[model samples]
Target chain A: MKLTLRVWRQKNADAPGAMAAYEVDGVSPDMSFLEMLDTLNEDLIVQGEDPVAFDHDCREGICGACSLVINGDAHGPERTTACQLHMRSFRDGDTIDVEPWRAAAFPVVRDLVVDRTALDRIIQSGGYVTAPTGSAPDAHAVAVPKPDADHAFVHAECIGCGACVAACPNGSASLFTAAKVNHLNVLPQGAPERESRVLDMVAQMDAEGFGGCTLAGECATACPKGIPLQAITTMNKEWLRAARTSKR
Target chain B: MSWTSCGWPPYGRRMALATRDRRPPTVRTLWDSSVGKKTVMAVTGLIMLGYLVAHMAGNLKIFFGADEFNGYAHWLRHLGAPVLHSHWALWIVRVGLVVSVVLHGVCAFQLSRRDIKARPVRYAHTKARTSYATRTMRWGGVILALFVVWHLLDLTTLTVNENAQAGHPYENVVATFSTWYGNVVYIVAMLALGLHIRHGFWSAAQTLGVGSAARARLLKGAANLLAAGLTIGFISVPVAVMTGVVN
Candidate 1:
């Protein structure tokens, strides 16, 4: 397959950027999206030009490291991570536009590489359980209801990919924060710090200059894991509940 | 692994408690949070939505006839009589609505500004991502706000109504709707109002955390129904006057 690419190129975070077009030939249909980029990069390196820089890890789509807004959709047209999206999804002669995630909270580091430490900051605020660390506990020691376990498992599917923020017109991180907050808030082990977890993480998100959610449902659509939008509603409920009842 | 063996997770519960110790949790009140501001927007939007329903119902009373409509108008002024002063109940309702409108508009404006600022760079390929009603919310809101001003001036103050009279609201309404520009502005504003409510109601439900997977469909349907009903109810008055059904 031969295709034209309108890839965004920037020298650094402080430098300006523009759409630099390139043509690639001899692309295999079985190659993943990143491998196609690898073909482009190999040609650029041979030509003594700076190749595009992006993030990718675990090429399996679970690490949440790969980030790209291809043709205006996060991770291209596929509902999976960029690394997991194959070249066959695109037709030959297609002109694909690739750019990094757009959000004040996630500033671009270089071409198609934006800093997502803001998400780490949010998790740091509160996204964990204070469980005792020792020998393995009995499986039946903690009895989690079936429904609650399902809720936790579903929310835990979030890969922290930042696709939600990239696709959101408002650049809101409500879904990501919601996923982290609800993943643990419903579990018996997570009960001790549940209230503080939501309150602090939400506050941290606000501090990161991310926009507020307007329920446009874009984030959930861009999500690779198919995390439901109702995750945000649950987070909002938890926040309100915490604000009302939390003592310290 | 080291973080675990060091006795506790460095970025977990201890961080939350340490921050709370340094500053009282109340120091960052609900108003300071994005979620909290949305609560304010949701509550105020609901208030305005309620008023629109009441206002549309009252507008329908014009179909009954001039005397009955005028009597209904008079009755509103003297509402809560023997205990409350004349126009007092009316004044109270008006003031509450004004507050609701102010808060709703302010929150919308602030949230929109932040939304724009959050994404300074635009995508190279511009694709329409959301629904028309969702995209036009900010502009539709502005149009509705300007229409509210014109509406109050034309009907309440008798400033823009043609050949105005103070006592007869039924006649004043007819005179206002009789003109072409009046019909044009009223109809356009009602359409904008419809679009606004179509998204606003459902959005408010999500912000307040009342909507869920089971009820999202219900809330969306209800929003559409309410938007259509209010727009038709209010626009019917002008249509009736123009068609000679109410004169």
Candidate 2:
């Protein structure tokens, strides 16, 4: 399959970028989206042109590293992440417009590559259990209610791709953050630092200059992992309690 | 101070003026119109909800004693640390709250209108992606607004109407709930408030960009607990008043 690719090009963060058109011929439909990009880069290298730069690490979609906004949709209209998206979805001679995730916090590094360190900062703020993960305790000692366990598992599946942020009109990451908060706090072991975790993570998320959530529902709609927006609501309730209790 | 386009020459100002024609095309507005209003609605709605929680807490002081409840309200009217709370301060807060309410209503109306206009063709199978709180935000706001007005009339106006107790402001609350309709409305409104608060609490965090997985989960849990508490607190007032628990 031959296709026209209008790819975003920029030398660096400070440089102006625009969509530069490239025509690639003799492409296979079975090639994954990233694989097609690899082929295009190989062709560019042979012609002494700088190949497009994009972030990808485990191309299997679990790493949340492959970030691309195909056309106007994040992760290309699929419920899955970019790495899991295959080229067969596109038709012959299709004009594919590719761009980086647009958000103030996730600035474009070069071409399709973006600096997602802000996500890491949000995680570092409170995404972990403060309780010492010591030697293994008796496995059957703590029995979690079935519903609680299911809810925690649902929240634990977030990949932190920033798709929720990108898809959100306000560029809010509450859905992503809430999932993390709920996942750990529901378990009995995570109780000690639950309040502090909520406070620290929320504070860090704000400090990173992410926009507020307007509840437009687009973020959850675009989320590859389908993380619910309810998680953010849960976080808010905790913050209020923490704020109030601390004042006392 | 001067026009520069990346070393490219600016189009001739005279040429631009010539191209400036009468009857300028009406610029189509996107989010700055629709989604922007929704944002304002979401934000102000959250503020109003915060006020509801605080207001309920204040009202629930009646459970302590009439003197305590009255003192709480009186203190609110006169309780500013550096500057004493006065009639003017009370009115100012009231006005501010009213303004927030109005802004919330206007933005909601505009956003809903846009939503209706944008999608004239309804989908065959479309489930609203909204949560319970978001789905009922408008209804909750309306209920709260009505409650505010009625509550003021119940306390401030002291109308010697048949429905109200003649000389007792507290008794009016009791008498209103003694009837089934009054209890029903109050309970229903509180439920609406619960729904609103459930969504609003966490939404406020998201709007402020403080949402994270752990924090969000905690916030949602807290919001549910708070909503339940507020509902019970508000409902307890009517229940207590009707049962003659409070003289």
Candidate 3:
């Protein structure tokens, strides 16, 4: 098989980049997307040319490190991470355009690597259990309702890929941040730090320069973990309540 | 200066609370942020709707004759509890209305900006999945904002093109509506306002957790009815005046 690639090339964060075209032959349909890229890189190395720089680890896709906006859709159109995307999804001789997630907060670290440390900052803002961090309470002590526990589990599956941010028109991470907020905020253990958790996470999200949510539901559609959009609704409700009741 | 120097000796011993920064998430998490804005949008939107209803009802009083209509206006200004002048009440209402409008607009603007920044590139398949009005709400909002300013200047402050002259307020309304250009402006603005209100009314309800199937149906019906009623009521004032039916 043959494929034409228009891949973004940048030397470093300060360098200007554009799509550079390449052609690879003898590609196999069975190769995963990254496997195909590996084949292309092998050829470039033999030819004494710089190999295309991309990010991927645990090509099985759970790491959330394989971030790419392929053919104009984040993580391609497979509803999964870029690492999980298979070459069979594309036709031979097709031209694939690859670019990094374009967001001010998630600056491009290299060709495809972005500094998602802001996401860590957002998480560190209060997405945690503050119950003295030392002793474990009995699991049965907290009596979490079945539905709430199920919802918390759903939000907890987020891999922090920033795909929601990339897919959003406002470059907003409400979906990602809300998932984290809702995950912890819903649990019995997270109750003690609820007010402070929401406040810190929200502040960190804004300080990182993300836009507010418009509730388009695209972030949910693009999510690899299938995080629900309702988490945002929950966050908004909590924020309003916090603002009104915290007059003291 | 020592913390205790001002008179409260324990001021220095007081600890600063480690308050968390709690701004709502950008529209990326629209569902989460939906609660606060939903409340604001719902409450404020309802207030604005109430104002519109009262305003139209007041305008309708013109059919009763100048003395009756003036008396109606005067009564609104004077007939409240404890004989509070309606103007004072009106001013208070106006302030509340303005606050609501600001909150609604601010929430929407923040959400829209986040949406724009989230996906800088236009989606290739957006047309198939999204409604035209939903997609264009941001631009429509800007138009409505501009329209609101012009509307206030024309009706409230009588500042239409700086040609506001002293005369009967109703006569000024009649003269303005009688002109072909004025009718055009009013009609255009009213149409946009109708579209803006159409989506907003029910959506605001939905945002504030009004998602029961029956409640959804009720809200939807009410929104359409309100939109249609307001459009026709406001438009009728201009139409009746222009056709010389009021005279």
Interface RMSD of each: 2.2, 16.3, 6.9
Expressed as tens digits, the lDDT of each residue in A1-248 for candidate 2 is: 99999898989999988889999887888888889999999999999999999999898878888788887677886788888888889999999888887777777899989888877777765677644356887879889999899989988899888888766655666677788888988888677657666655665665565655557677778888888876765666565555435321
Summarize candidate 2's per-residue lDDT along B146-170 as a digit string, tens digits. Answer: 8767666655675422467544445
Model 1 Cα lDDT, one tens digit per residue, B64-95? 99999999999999999979999999999999
Best by DockQ: 1
Q: Model 3: how far is A41 from its true place, Å?
A: 3.0
Which candidate number would show the highest TM-score if scored against the true structure? 1
Give the TM-score of candidate 1 (chain A): 0.98
Model 1: per-residue Cα lDDT over A1-248, one tens digit each: 99999999999999999999999999999999999999999999999999999999899999999999999999989999999999999999999999999999999899999999889888877887886789989999999999999999999999999999999999999999999988999999989888888988888888888999988899999999988999999999898888878887
For model 1 chain B, the run of ten residues with the poorest summed lDDT = B13-22
Better of 2 and 3 by lDDT: 3
Write model 3 residue lDDT over B178-219, tens digit each, in one string.
678888888877776676667777666645544344465687
Lowest summed lDDT over 10 consecutive residues: which window, candidate 3 chain A? A239-248
Q: Candidate 2 chain B: worst 10 consecutive residues by lDDT?
A: B12-21
lDDT, residue A29, model 1: 90
**Candidate 3 per-residue C-alpha lDDT over A40-153 given as tens digits, one digit per residue, 9 for 90 to 100:** 889999999888788787877788888888887789879899888888899998998888887777877777777887787777656777564458777787799998999799
lDDT values for all models: 0.90, 0.70, 0.72
